[model samples]
Target: MNTINTHYRLSHQIQDEAFILSQAAKCNLYLSISQKSIRLAVMDTERNKFVVLEDYELITVFTPMQVAEQLRLIAQENPLLQEQKWNTIRLAISNIHFTLVPETLYDPAHQHDYLRLHSDLNPLQDVVLAYRHNSLEAINIFSLDASTYQALEALFPERQLQFVHQTSTLIRSVLHLAPRTNLRSMYVFVERNYVTLLVVGPSGLEFCNIFHYLSPEDFIYYIIFVMQEQKMNPEQETIMVWGDITHDSSLFNILQKYIRQIKLGKKPSDLEYSYKFHDMFEHRYFELYSLHLCE
Candidate 1:
């Protein structure tokens, strides 16, 4: 069951028959939070399979308080989210104000300083956080609205929450899924109005950035521009795509017009999914699923 209100709209809800509310303590809860949307995913740790998934498309939520209020409304409706305790609670924040810094250069004391270079973060309004990438030997520094962060804290007051940047989760999952070779490969995560372009190399992530587009032309332009900057041949190098796009989408059609090889990415191979998810697009909710890979 789902509902659509003035503040937010429920877009997808999938659950396995085996999911039991009484056994929620044995499951892990993951949430992907942003101003545009909030997604909830539940994984049964004992079986290592995802049992529940929900996506809410937020509307006109531009301020921190607005986003926080929307989250409260969602929690009120989602029974799964109403559960306070779980095996683990992971929340990923999505925003453009994030910068990747090498682990060697990262200083926890100056995390805010690092992010300041990329965005104008207000000390009173924004909270700076960092997620370390152990495998990639890098750190992702990002900002979250202080009020929104506090709202999450208040909601799960007793539960220990693990916060991570959306890009960090994407990077972690892509590395594990990308082939280990010297050849550079590009992986794209497409969302409502933005696309995250990542180029993974043999050793680690070569390039990663988010681009906002107003049109299909802007979307393909960024993709092609990044490929050119990386010196990847569009004819030879293949791009694997995931997220809220379809094969018939104008974004995909334009992508096909320029790039010779484009492949739709599959769900993480190491993880299992419930049969309820079989009918859904495998590429969608990738970052939400990748939360399992986040530390």
Candidate 2:
């Protein structure tokens, strides 16, 4: 197997040592070896606004072309990125990571099935850590299990893949390894086997949660429990729900009551990124969380 080392430097020394300890225990946390730099940006389709994040620093405005140009420059500098020849790359623009697959891919009626490989911070682990820190800043890494991995290969002989990272610290590190305004807080949620990611900052937060076997009720219960444990008032926080579960008006209504504000988090213009290079996914989820959260 091939491995890539990416490092990030932050302006602010994470002051919550207890929180860091908690995260390390729950999620497998490790320091990166290579201090690589990258730039990321996202567009708020509804507000007609653009937000660019570099090395944890935030840039007020950026066009789609500008984002593309930045990626091109990174690819030029990094040999591995240049090898991918990817049309686009997906980035969190915040300090979190998630997996995004076409909605159609999950349809049971669909005959083809292919496994998508993702590398980023682990969500379950990150949530545990973030809760301990009393901060939403976190990252996520995703990959398929052995059984699912094999099943996907049988379903789709041809691979349908995209590489993206949605971690807050990693995104900031990529920008310049220094803190920035655009890169804000991030949260991770998972249900069934799929991962849902949420990122918030000056431009407002976006949410995307997906699950196959778990019901929306279960997902909400977890959210409520986590918030309660962390002493977070859900009633004061804005929440946006997405995916098949949100289709149910009844469920959506219930969520709206519990959350400060609720909306469906989807923006077409937000789809832009350099789809190459996988992230590290070797650490244990619980270990990472415990190390980052628990004192």
Tens-digit lDDT string for candidate 2 (166-258): 233322222221124654433443322343444445444333333322565765675666556545578775554433243445555656667
Best by lDDT: 1
lDDT of each: 0.90, 0.32
Instruction: Count the clashes in each prediction.
Output: 0, 68
Model 2, stretches more than 4 Å misplaced?
1-142, 145-216, 268-295
TM-score for all models, in order of appearance: 0.96, 0.31
- How does model 1 score by TM-score? 0.96
For model 1, residues 1-295, the per-residue Cα lDDT tens digits are 5453459999899988889888888999999988789999999999899999999998887777788888888788778778887889999998898998989998899998899999999999999988888887888999999988998888888987899999998999999888888888999999888999999887778999999998999999999999999999888888999998999999999999999988998888788999999998889999999999998
Using TM-score as the measure, the top candidate is 1
lDDT at position 119, candidate 2: 33
**lDDT value for candidate 1?**
0.90
Q: Estimate the overall C-alpha local distance difference test score of candidate 2.
A: 0.32
